[model samples]
Target chain A: MSQSDYDYLCDFLKERSGLALAPDKEYLVDNRLLPVARRHGRKTVAELIQMLKGPDSGHLKVEVTEAMMNNESYFFRDRVPFDRLGDTVLPDLLRTRALRKKIRIWCAAASTGQEPYSIAMQLDQRAELGGWRVEIAATDISGDAIERAKAGLYSQFEVQRGLPIQMLMQHFEEVAGQWRIVERLRNRVDFQTINLLTDFSRLGQFDVVFLRNVLIYFDRDTKLDVLARVRESLAPDGYLLLGAAETMVGLGDLFKMVPETRALYRPNVAPKKPELALVPGGARVA
Target chain B: MKRCLIIDDSSVIRKVARRIFEGFGFTISEAADGRQALDACVTEMPEAILLDWNMPVMDGYEFLRALRAMPGGDRPKVVFCTTENDLAHIARAMHAGADEYIMKPFDKEIVEAKLQEVGLI
Candidate 1:
């Protein structure tokens, strides 16, 4: 691919999906976009780029974006995050939102649906979450990804990556070499195709937003822009989670980093003092 | 025979580590979590421990801290075998008193070599 062609493709993608493809990513673009070109019956990536620049290339852009965005995902990606979410974060959210009687969660960039499904599984395990009105909205930029997430089918290798065998047995049924996530877990999550760079007001507000592992691809400006949008969608007392390596530092003042957990961020909510009172006789209240 | 305890939440990982130790003539004990591993460390008093970083009840870092707090002659040499391969994770593990750090999907030879270096074999 020529430098100009690469630049054209990058600019197109940046405008459409907010993915700022660097110059050095030519090889990656060639490898990933070639199949997209072939799928659209184009002879070369340059031709595909030309088509993308043309007035009537809406369908082609969608295909290219979908191709670029579909990522490898399993029942659980990193076990530690899920553990922290289940043990610490979810419980805190439940307690904090007790009076509200409802909770909204959004899994941003929910590739193949594993992350939201895993959360749903964890919530189901607690039994108490069932009492609350919980809505899980999972979105990915790729329509293909959203479709796959909806299917809830996973291969053996994919299932084994992070999911424990007990969870596998409990929540999935084996069909040949693949495992299908049970209907109960599938029903809990609402999956849609949503680009983070674009306006997400349609998603409404979320008490917890998981935008993990998807920000590394963007440049600083895009990260900041996406973070702002995410901040807007987040409820006042909401939590925003990123990948282990990603952080909100220097990028935005919309979130405060939660201590100890590397990627956890909280919206600008006033720190509530612990409920404590002194007894009339000078004893402390528990 | 040298007694070694393998502390990990993953059954497959423990099974693999058990096979590796069994090949080296060490008797193996197992614990599913950090709390169980601490209890087993006192009761069984294994010579060495192959610990995983993440687990339920308690994590390896907490287990290591408790093991260090125990009276002398009971604390076992520990090697962290986990999927956390980042340099920061390695530094944290070493700082927490892990004798060696081994990443998961570990080669059997490397496991044996680390065990030999630590005088566990």
Candidate 2:
């Protein structure tokens, strides 16, 4: 891709998804947009760039963005956070929010629905949550991902990734060399296409949000902007889970890191001066 | 039989490691992320830990630090099983108290040999 074409693509992506593409990311843009180009009958990446520049290519831009956003995901990804959620966090939240009698969980950027479905399965397994009104809302930037999430079909490779055998047998049915998440578990989660950069007011408030592993693509300003909006949609004392490498330090004062669990964050209801700790690799540990 | 914990984000790697260790008559426990591995280490007390470098919740580097800091001599010998083969990566793994390093796409015999060399078998 030419420098000007790359710059135009970056600008388009930034305006749509709040994702800033650096000059070094040309290879990534080319690799991701190839299929989109082919689908549009364009012979080369250059042709696709020209198509994107034309007035009729607005839909193609959305298609390219969606294709880039479809990330790899599988059931029960990164078991510890789920274990923590099941063992310590969920129990605590249940007890603390007893008066509300309802719990709202949102999985933002829930690619392929693994994270939210896993959460739903965990809640279903817990006999104590029987009486509570649980609403699980899962959203992804790509409509394709949301559709797949709704289908609840997974391949052997995906099933073997992180799913335990017991849970697999219990919550899913084998279908022609694939596993389909059972209707009961699938029904608990509502999947929709929602771009985090866009308005989230329609989604309403959430008690717990899983926004893991998606922030790495954004620049510092976009990260801050996204988190601020998340904070607005979050309930007081709501929990936010981020990827392990991601931190709220140097980003903004919207949240505080929960001790011991590097991935867990809680909204900063009361203003406290930010304290800096030097974690290994010079990454800030809040 | 000795107990082994395989911690990697990739199911393919985990399955391969499980089969390799099971072939050597070792009981295998698996964790897909670093935090789960730490919990399994505490609960199961495996004789050795086979760790991967990159993961989402907690990477292998942080897991190594946490494992080394655990109380008592019960800390198991760790062998770094990762795709990272660069000298800097090796140096970092060693600095984090890794006893041995095994590169990815490992054959069964190579992994068995590494295990035996570390006296895991």
For TM-score, the strongest prediction is 2
TM-score of chain B of each: 0.94, 0.94
**Tens-digit lDDT string for candidate 2 (B8-106):** 999998998899889988889999999999888777688888999999899999999998888732468788888775446767888788877776666
Q: Which stretches of candidate 2 lie over 4 Å from their true place?
A: A271-286, B1-121
Taking all chains together, the TM-score of candidate 2 against the true structure is: 0.69
lDDT of 1 by residue, A66-122 (tens): 766648775556555676677778888888988877889999989988899888888
lDDT against the true structure, per candidate, is: 0.78, 0.79
Worst 10 residues of 2 chain A by lDDT: A276-285
Can you tell me the DockQ of model 1?
0.03
What is the TM-score (0 to 1) of chain A in model 2?
0.91
Clashing pairs in 1: none
Off by over 4 Å in 1: A269-286, B1-121
